[model samples]
Target chain A: MDNLSMQKLLWGVFWITSLAIGMVVAGRLWHMRLLADVSVRSRVQQSLQLVAKREGWLISDMSIRSVTPDAVIIEHRQHMRGRDPRVCVRIPLGTLEILPCTS
Target chain B: MLLRVLVFGLLQGFAVLLAELHRYLGVHTDEAKYLLNIPYPHPPLMRWILETTDGWQHQEIFWRIVFASLLTQGTWFVWDMGRKLHKDQRVTLCGLWLFSGALLLQAGTLFMPTITAIETLFLCWILQRIEFLKRWSALIPLLWLEMLFVAYQGILFAPLIFVALRQSGIAPWQRWSAFLIPIGLLALYTPTNPLTIVATGSVSGMSMGMPLEESVARVLKLWVIGGSMALSVLGLYGMVKSKQYPLVLTLMLVTAYIFVGFRSFYAILFTPLLIAGLLSAPKLLKSSAFLLALQIAAGTAIFLYVPFPEYSSARSVGDALRVAGVHGDILIAGSFGHEWQYLMPGPVKRYRPDFTNDAAAIVCLDRCVAIDRQAWQRFPQTTEEVWVKIRD
Candidate 1:
């Protein structure tokens, strides 16, 4: 192969490798949940606490179950006089409003 | 008619992206200062330009559009420069496509001096290529003044200007004398002289420089984000193979500067030469175009999905305060005060640790103030935590 053929081969290899990498990166970013990252868990917790404070709801305990683009799913026990009920609630990400448990 | 539609469609796409970015980001500290018209510690030209959008309903959006327009001009000039170098429209277009996907363009949506600096450098390159300086030698002083007033960083391009002058075959005395007028005029204007201010305070005030290992890491990160790894690798190969010593010199200067003080937007300076490198290999144009398209897609995906919350929380904090029915003067504790001051429609006072005030609300950003939990009602967001006074 001459120089032109050699350059063409290199370009082909680059195109394939870059596309593969690009696809993987996009997939990873798409699936990434802000709550799942251990580093940002504190922030998520603080947000949940802020929501609880704002709504004047006393919580026995809370743990993040999953996070969507717009909301975070969490299992929490709202403080009651004699009963603690663990329920999954969906809280909007930035707005931090805890809605009634879906299921 | 087809071409017109194509151009129109591309512009519409660009405008949408600009709007998305404008809505996504909160005003950064640097951008906030410029937005507030605080032109000190840097040249005033950028602030003056931004002042054009004052009183507009959507001033930030208008600012982004203005910057995007300037960067588009810079990108066009780079495409034209590629054409001059390669004499092949296809190769130049491919280079331009690769540049559009580069991290520089992705981050250029913000209001910053990087775009203006890039525009000045691109204009200089195009003028030098076309021998504009040689044709109109009298404009040399004017060009110098423009460079000086635009940004202090413009002094880096002196070597390129010198090269342009040499290529023009102008008399050495004439070329040397042209710089004198601009220098004397700049010295006369003490307040705006970027050099004097930079010399006295910038080094200590900026807290510039880091360990070599960190500096290298930062540059590598910028290289990957500014241009894709493939583009950079190919560009490096071409730079070595083409033996373009002047381009290499500029790269070294820029690298050294980045080592001293690195901002991600400094990546714009490397773009023209990187495109030049892409143009050097004619055989790879088709494959390179495909790779560039992939880069554009991937870059856009990351930019939209990833949440970088720094300096973007001010507007949200302001909105939350407004919703809480807190009005009149508010005290801001901690940094990014300018961003809050600009975002809020009401009077904003910076909170001092010693100062006592009867403000209804105090928003602490990135840093928390010592406040009695009983005295203030706290509303915390992801980044900014607002404390509204409850006690009289």
Candidate 2:
């Protein structure tokens, strides 16, 4: 191969290598970050279960009222069938201590 | 000589000021994502740069300094670009000053895709103007790959490739191949660098067919934040008057951005052409110094007053964390948890119930996951509920 072709080959190789290395490094970093913790969804589910068990509500019947970064608010219907029968409980994150949520 | 010195001095001064203030700013959530190598949907090249350069650590202030340095050096490229395009020192000096005074001096220091895009645009311009691509036809593939990696948006400016190769005397087949090779290579890199993401984004961008009023508001913001309303208007006028490739390039960029999705930072790319137009009107040359002063004052005011909410919140949280001496399995929950992860002293993880431990401090940002308001030491900093576990 001529010098120009050789040069071209080297340039292509260098860039491809750089790109590959960069991508690999980025991927590895992402993988490490991913592995660092449990999935947020699973965590939220655990919180829900804890809240349900403590409140004497069936885990299946307890529906997620809202999900926030700090806590998941779970909604439960009281045994009393009346207007506005649904009651909401606050499961503050970290402690999972259920509290009465107003409004 | 005087104008050159003045422009350089102004650029350096603003660059230093930005670097100084950037130190106090909290690690923005976007910056955190990039630093931590979080798998964002956009192109990974910018993240790669951020992660590699910061040694795979959260060194936001250091990166800001580096960005500021690059912006200062970019002023030189802008000067040289003006000189090459206009072939007049006065035009070059005037354009340089105008560029130095623009809001870009502040925005360029940010750890965003804006700087990468601006740098890519500058390199593309330099390559074309120097006819470097024409001479080295083989380098086209490498350039394209680099452009794609650094700023996939660079693909939008592909007209420069044709302009570069237009009179290279290379056979039409070779010229066409030079331009076409990158598009083919893009497919090969698809597994790693997904062009589909760009396509998807573009399609979604189309779906977001903005109302005319909103579109006008955005354009107005682009002009004002880009540099100045007058400069953007003159830049448009100048491009039209020159009837050059720059005009076509400007139109392509503006149309793509406005119709596809508009961002004020994209103005960094347009400012150069605007400066070029400002220079074209020699009648405005006498008042150039006054314009520069006005722009400097304007940019400075924006820099000082513009309340970047993320940065402020980050700073406040970071300070509180530092004071609390937070460490060892820090659990960050809520929006911008990645940001807290970057600020934390030890292994910072997103809050998970299964992952909970007594030793771990749960930081609930924004609205704390319904934190027991009575028990946890609530650091009511910056209107966000910053909860740290005080007990087992």
The lowest-lDDT stretch of 10 consecutive residues in candidate 1 chain B is B187-196
Query: What is each candidate's fraction of native interface contacts (fnat)?
Result: 0.00, 0.00
Candidate 2: where are CA atoms >4 Å away? Answer: A1-103, B1-10, B55-58, B84-108, B120-128, B131-141, B167-174, B185-210, B276-312, B346-355, B366-383, B389-392
lDDT of 2 by residue, B1-392 (tens): 99878867877776666777656655555566566544443455676676665443335666776677666656665565555343444443444434432344354245454564454546444553556544555555456556665554556657655655555456787567656655544443443322234444865485286687777676666555555555666656665676656545745665566545664445566555565555455454445556556656665565455455446365565566668776455555554445654565544544555444442456556344545545557665534555665654
Listing candidates in order, what is each one's chain A TM-score? 0.46, 0.51
Lowest lDDT 10-residue stretch of candidate 2 chain B: B187-196
Candidate 1: give the clashing pairs: B26-B312
Best by TM-score: 2
Clashing pairs in 2: A69-B334, A70-B368, A70-B369, A71-B369, A92-B370, A93-B369
TM-score for candidate 2, please give it: 0.67
lDDT of 2 at B99: 49
